[model samples]
Target: MTPYENVTFKERLHEEAAKLKEMSFRDKFWYIWEYYKFPIIGVVIAVFLVGSIGSAMYNNRFDTALSCAVLNSRYDSEALTVDQYFDEGFRAFIGLDENTKIDVDYSMSPSFDESAMNEYSYAELAKLTAMISSKGLDVMIGRPDVIDHYGEMDGFLNLEEALPADLYEQVKDYLYPVTNAETGQESFCGIRIGDTSFGEKTGLILEDPVLTIMSNSPHTDTAIQLIRYIFEQ
Candidate 1:
């Protein structure tokens, strides 16, 4: 029996339209906000979320061809140079497309000496552990101590098994043996690269640099190719 009881949807629409036409812009905005504030806010938030998700997906679209980590590196200035050199050179050597990515991480600098260890070192160690556990890292280049630290955890692939016979034989004299902590078995886990022309070519000042491939690497072929490419260069 109320005045609204007789009103149809079309009549309500017309009444609102007429009221909006007579109102000022500010009044109209307030009126609409009063009526549709929740819906407008919800739509805006939904759009923002969608845009954020789309951007993230697009940015991460490329597949990683190789993921190499340089731990406890002495030369901080060579990070960009190393990253660019390997990324471009390796891509060209392998004929990889632009859509594929090669990641070279040089940020980690974990200290082996307990007295020298700090929060940053601990964080770097955690990051390295996470990367290895997730199979996100393919290769590691570091000092002998750094290489041995991870090798003790059985982190690296035995070069005898991981590499082709010819390649293993080629670098047999440079092999760095590490004893597995769990099994107490000794194996060749890394190859010494510091004595090579790697430092001069890459502008990295390495002292006893060793290269090791991860045991759980998903890109073993690519990693092997990388080692071959390094030696070739």
Candidate 2:
């Protein structure tokens, strides 16, 4: 009922605002945080959830550390036709121990095309390019024409350079010449797994396929091991 009673509503509002402005910086920060804490927490949780989903999708799209795809458009079987017995052998060779068994993603598809993409549609070509760049393709088993096409683009690893000394010796004689698509020059870029062997002394029987490693393959050791097992069998 004294001087405070004389203060009008406008004056009281200004007084409170001035008091707030005069508050310490730390106090103001706490005031703001307390007022908006719920919203801030919600925003943070939303960001975290989005990031988690995005990371999972990215990994699922490109993760193929143990996959080996054989591209042969001539054969259209969706399921793997390779003998399971060899799969068992390769798994045993690559596994860490007796109890720690490994699963191999052996796949075959006839949809692949050369760098020119003469046979693949736009979507198929894009998927193929992505697979190659991501190192998802470990080994490629195809006929001579297909091998030659990829070899020209430097897509396949040079067998002479990639195989171990012992394994190289076993297959060196069977690596047939292929004309590079880019250079128009011939190179020993593929091993003829079909109808040939290392002079028959090794008792290795050849099948009707040419095997090559992708240049960007992450599992070169496994690829070599698989090749070795195939020829040995």
Candidate 3:
């Protein structure tokens, strides 16, 4: 047969080349490249910038969230816990220490005194002593205690459910404290960070006392700054 009838390689190649010019993926790509290069580049750059900024912002936000929580607690002068970082923020809302605290307990059906514990746990006595001395009170328990007390914040009450009805109203402003172990009575009353007083009578609770207790009270702006520092990245 003639070379033309047999379809020579060169002839087949030429035929394919012509068909590609008319209908090929490469040809279609050229049209797209010529028309949309600028718009495509712009979209890519915008997406990269947005993703980078978003990642940076997310990192910064976590740093701020942790810091604010810590600072708020320090402003109140309360001790913090490992788990506290993840908890609801209650640091600056009250006393320097978290109000969710409980005093040691020693119950005695027949009025038993805890003489042994006194030697080991004089911390409570020390606190009371310091509170009295700072207040310029008689420096004695129950002698120079809160007389005309009260809080000013509108939503500061902590009337926990376990309390007796009469005691509930009495200690609601105490800020969610646990009952004293020995007395079995609630003692979370007032913002007594050795100074920040609160109660139901004065309407202006913490003005006078904090000045004495703070000596530069942790209840001040300085304390809050420390909180910020400790909680930051």
Winning candidate number (TM-score): 1
* Error of model 3, residue 23, in angstroms: 4.0
Q: List TM-score per model, in order.
A: 0.71, 0.54, 0.19
**On residues 1-233, what C-alpha lDDT tens digit does candidate 3 reach at each position?**
76458898898779756755786798757765576667765665555455545644554443221111100011232332323422322234323344332111111111113554332133333333332333212111010122112111111122243234653454344332333344455533222222222211112222222111112121234223322222231
How many clashes show up in model 1?
0
Q: Residues 1-233, candidate 2: write the lDDT tens digits.
A: 68669899999878767867988989877875776666765665555455545643565665333445445433224433343433455566556344332223223333444464332233344444556776656776666766776787878777777788998899888886666666777766677776533213222222356877777887777778777866875
lDDT of each: 0.80, 0.60, 0.31
In candidate 1, what residue range of length 10 has the lowest lDDT sum?
Answer: 47-56
- Clash counts for all predictions: 0, 4, 17
Query: Which residue pairs of candidate 1 clash?
Result: none
Badly placed stretches (over 4 Å) of model 3 are: 1-22, 64-233
